[model samples]
Target chain A: QQQVKQSPQSLIVQKGGIPIINCAYENTAFDYFPWYQQFPGKGPALLIAIRPDVSEKKEGRFTISFNKSAKQFSLHIMDSQPGDSATYFCAARRYRDDKIIFGKGTRLHILP
Target chain B: DAGITQSPRYKITETGRQVTLMCHQTWSHSYMFWYRQDLGHGLRLIYYSAAADITDKGEVPDGYVVSRSKTENFPLTLESATRSQTSVYFCASSGYFGDKDRWYGYTFGSGTRLTVV
Candidate 1:
C-alpha cells in the first residue's frame, strides 16, 4: 500500500503562474512532511518541509500548506519560472520511524 | 567530495547476471538507505540500516541484498538481475535524530542508473 498518495502525475503551467501539487496520507502518526525536487538524471534534493503543528511554511518561492486533520498537504510555487520545471515529490515520516514514505511524484513543467 | 557518493553512475548488465551498487558517505552518518525510482511508481525504499551491522527491509526488498559492515559504506547487490529491476537507484544518509522536534532531511547521492538487458 502506498503510504503517501499524490495527485496529477504531471502538471504544466505558464511562467509567472502558480503550480500546486498535492499529497495525502492516511497515517496519523506522521508528523513531518517534506517536498523534494529532482532534475533529469539527478537525485532528489530537499526543497522545503513543514511540521504538522504549523498550518504552513514558506521558503522563497516555495511554500508548503499542511492540514493535519485532513491528512493532506500541498506544495505551491509562487511566480513559477521555467527553472522550476522538475519532478516534485512529497514525503512524510513518523516520529518513531526514521524512514520516509514518498508519494508517486508530480512532474511539473513551466512554459515560458 | 565530502558528501555521499555512488559508484558507476551508469551500468548495463545482462539478465541473470549479478550486479552490485556501491554507496559511500564521508559524514559517517548513522543511518543509510537504498531506494529505487521508477516511472509512475516513484521512489520505493529497498533497504536501510540504522547503524553498522544493523539493517532492515523496506517497502521493496525482494531479489535485493544490502550490507552495512561499516559506518560510511553500504552496498546493495542483486543476485540475479532482472528487467524489472532496471531503474535509478539512490543512496541517502542522515544523522541520528534523537530529537523528534528537529527535522533533518536526508542527503541523497547523485544516483546510479542500472539497466538490465
Candidate 2:
C-alpha cells in the first residue's frame, strides 16, 4: 500500500505560470512533510519543507499549502521557468522516526 | 567532498552475477538509506541503517543486501542480479541541526544507474 498518494503523474505549464502538485497521506503520525526536485543524471535534492503547525509556508518562488485536517498538502511554483522543469516528490516522516515515506512522483515540464 | 557519494555512476551486469554498489558520506550522519528509483514507481526504500552495524529492510529487499560496518560507508550488494532489479540506486544520509528545535534533512548521492540483463 502507498502511504502517500500524489496526483497528476505529469504536469505541463507555460513559462511564468504557476504549477501546483498535490499529495495526500494516510498516516496522521507523520509530522514532517518535504518536497524534493530531481533533474536528469542527478539525484533528488531537497526543495522545500513544511510542518503541520502552519497552514502555509513559502520560500522564494515555492510555496507549500498544508491542510492538516484533510491530510493533504500541495506544492506551488510561482513564475515557473524552464529550469524548474524536473521530477518532484512529496514525502512524509513520522515524529522521531528515521524512515521517510515518499510518494510516487510528479514530472513537471515548463514550456518557454 | 562533504556530501554523500555513490560509486560506478553506471553499471551493466548479466543475470545471476553478483554486484556491489558502494556509498560513502562525509557528514557522519547517524542515519543512512538506500533507495531505488524507477519510472511510475518513484523512489522506493530498499534498506536503511540508523548507525554502524545496525541495518533494517525497507519496502523492497527481496534480492538486495546492505551493510554499514562504519559510519561513513554503507554498501549494498546483490547476491544474484536479476533483470527486474535494473533501476537507478541512490544513497542518502540524514542529519539534524539547531539547538532549540532540531531540523532534519537528507543529502542524496549522485546515484548509480544499474542495468541487469
Candidate 3:
C-alpha cells in the first residue's frame, strides 16, 4: 500500500513561474512532513519541513503549505529556475514508525 | 564538512557474486541506517543499528546483511547478488534519540550505484 501518494509523475514549468507538487498521507498519526530535492547522481537533500502545528512555513522562495485537517501538504517553489529542475520527493513520518515513508516521486523540469 | 560517505561510489558485479558496500560517518552518531532506492520503491530501509552492537531489520531486509561493529561504520553485504538487488544504495545516520520520539534529522551519503549483471 502506498501510504503517501504523490500526483503527476512529472511536470514541466517555465522559469520564474511557480511549480507546485502535492502529496497526501493516509496515516493521521504522521506529524512530520518534509520535502527533498534530488539531483541526478546525488542524494536527496532536505529542502523544507514543517510540523502539523503550523499551517504554513516559508523560507526564502520556498514555501510549504500544510493542511492538518486534510492530511495533505504541498511545496511551492517561487521564481523557479532552470537549476531547480530535479526530482522532488515528499516524505511522511509517524510516531509508530521512525523511518520516513516517501512518495513515489515527481520529476519537475524548469524550462528556460 | 566530511559527513557520511559511501565507498566505491559505483560498483558492478555479476549474479551469485558477493559484494559489500561500506558506509562511514565522521560524526560518531549512534544511529545508522541502510536503505535501497529503486525507481518505484522510494527509499526502503534495509537495516538499522542503534549502537555498536544493537541492530534491527527494517521494512525490506531480505537478501541483505548489515553490521555495526563500530559506531561510525555500517556495512551492508549481499550474500549472493541477484538482478533484483541492483539499485542505488544510500546510507544515513541520525543522532541517538529516545524510542518513537522526535530525533534529529538524517544526513545521507552521496550513494553507491550497484549493478548486478
Fraction of true inter-chain Cα contacts (below 8 Å) kept per model?
A: 0.77, 0.81, 0.58
Q: Write the per-residue lDDT of candidate 1 for residues B84-104, one digit (tens) a residue.
A: 999999999977456656657
Q: Each candidate's DockQ score against the native complex?
A: 0.85, 0.87, 0.58
User: Could you give candidate 3's per-residue lDDT for residues A1-112 as a string of tens digits?
Assistant: 6899987779999999999999999988787888888899998888888899999999988999999888889999999999999999898866543567788889999999
Worst 10 residues of 3 chain A by lDDT: A93-102
Q: Tell me which residue pairs clash in candidate 1.
A: none
Classified by CAPRI criteria, candidate 2 counts as: high
| Over 4 Å off, model 3 | B96-104
For each candidate, what is chain B's TM-score? Answer: 0.94, 0.96, 0.91
Better of 2 and 3 by TM-score: 2
Q: Compose the digit string of candidate 1's lDDT tens values, residues A1-112.
A: 9989998899999999999999999998887898999999899998999989999999999999998889999999999999999999999976675789999999999999
Q: What's the true lDDT of residue B56 in model 3?
A: 93
Candidate 3 local lDDT, residue A11: 94
Q: How does model 3 score by TM-score?
A: 0.92
Question: Per-residue error at B69 for model 3, in Å?
Answer: 1.5
Worst 10 residues of 3 chain B by lDDT: B95-104
For the predicted complex of model 3, DockQ is 0.58
Instruction: Find the 10 residues in a row with the least total lDDT in model 1 chain A.
Output: A92-101
